[model samples]
Target: MLLVTGITGHTGKYFLKELINNKYQGVIRCVVRETSDTSLLDNSGLNIEKVVGNLNDKSFVEQIMPGVEAIMHIYNIHHSPVIVETAIKNKVKRAILVHTTGIYSNFKYASQEYKNVEQKVFELTKQKECPTKVTILRPTMIYGDICDSNMSKFIKMVDKLRVIPVINKGESLLQPVNARDLGKAFFNVLLSPTETSGKVYDLSGEKPIKMIEVFRIISKEFNRQTTFVSVPLSLGELLAKSIKIITLGRINYVEKVQRMGEDRSYSHINARNDFGYNPMSLEEGIRIEVKEYLEAKDIR
Candidate 1:
């Protein structure tokens, strides 16, 4: 039995579907909050055993840990470590920890709580001497049509707002990975036996390109005209910090976003080499994203 947390999220849906589509002959159970809205996952019915409970509930969760084989951990928050600790205590075979590449690029953009969660996971993994071999993956700037977050927000604004905020030639590097390349990743990691234990993989598409070029290609595809503004990197950071204050700390999203300028580019060869996990290029991804975004807007 492979237990998957965060099973209701975008990446989790794709991962679970991929597992079932490829015909993995194993029981796949999905963790969900008791109050979680299951309308989105209605398509992937009965196959997904919706384990209802919050991550905070340790005792009730422990009851279901008996027959568990391995766990695909798509969780990242601090409270989520409870699941891993329990998984380890229950002697689950393997754990695939889905982490973020913010540990590298734009790490400064991360809130103190985010990094704390990562550290706690690592520490718990070390302390338990847990029998479950743990593997970590860092996925950066993940996107698709359903998203209006991060770069997707910029993509949606291109046609509506003629002018866009572009920085320093608008060429910051981006390695946007599609959600589909996730199937083989978890399967392969589970197949690695013990070699994958305690290993962390930085996952991304093979090619990382400049953000300006990415926007330009998408703009041309959509017949959108966009004006660019040059904001100094330092000014961008200051603006972000100010937004954090002006919004009474509720709108610190820019504080984290502006940090994307630092080393946004990375090589996914490691992920490719490890589990044959290769993501599609930015062009192919954008083509799909823009098409969907346009179609959805038409219906709206």
Candidate 2:
């Protein structure tokens, strides 16, 4: 049986769909909050046992950890250390943590936090005293659904803004992995538990594209002649900081502006070699996202 957390999220839903499409024989135990929408799982028509509870609760996690061959934890990095520890205690064979490639970036808060989590998990799993093998997958900017943060936000921005802004000539590159492909990568890692164990893989798209080209792609998808304004990074950071103050820290102004000038592209060679992580092209992926967005918004 496989224990999956965050089965209702964008990636989780896709992962469950992949598991169903591939006809995975294992019984899946999904741990989600009581109020989480299980419609995706309900419609999946796969072998799934739903557990409604908080993963932060040690007792609840410990109770469900036994007899589970592998665990794919897709959310809540803060709770991962405890979850991995419990899995080790219960003799679970393998654990896969779906992290983000942002950890490798210059973002201060998120990078430090993810680094801590990675360090903790790796240190624990490396101990000969611990039996449960752990594998970590870091996926770059995921974008395939209306619920995604990267392309979806770009789609909405391009849909609204008369003149879209591109910071630092938008020269920084991004390689976005489709959420569906990320799900497949998780499944592949699960199948080759021994091969992927104790390893960290960076899952990204096939090619890195400039941010300017990204905006062009989205604009093309929207079928709108949008004007591009190349804003200086320093000025953008100033505006972002001001907005941050006005928004009462609701947004990450520094990270957002700084990341605009830094390349976010990463190599997926290791993941491809280990687990056959083949992601769709950015153009095709964004086209799918645009189609879905148009359908959802009832717009042609």
What TM-score fits each model? 0.88, 0.96
Best by TM-score: 2
Residues 196-228, model 1: lDDT tens digits? 777888777658787778778778877877777
Candidate 2 residue-wise lDDT, 1-300, digit = tens: 899998899898888888888988868999988789998888787888988888767899988887898999998777889988888888888889988888988755689988898888877787787889888889988888899978899999888997988898889999989999988999899999767998989999889999999999999998889888999989998998988899998975787788888899999999988888889999999899999998988864
What's model 1's TM-score?
0.88
Model 2 spans with C-alpha error above 4 angstroms: none
**Model 1 regions more than 4 Å off:** 34-46, 105-115, 127-129
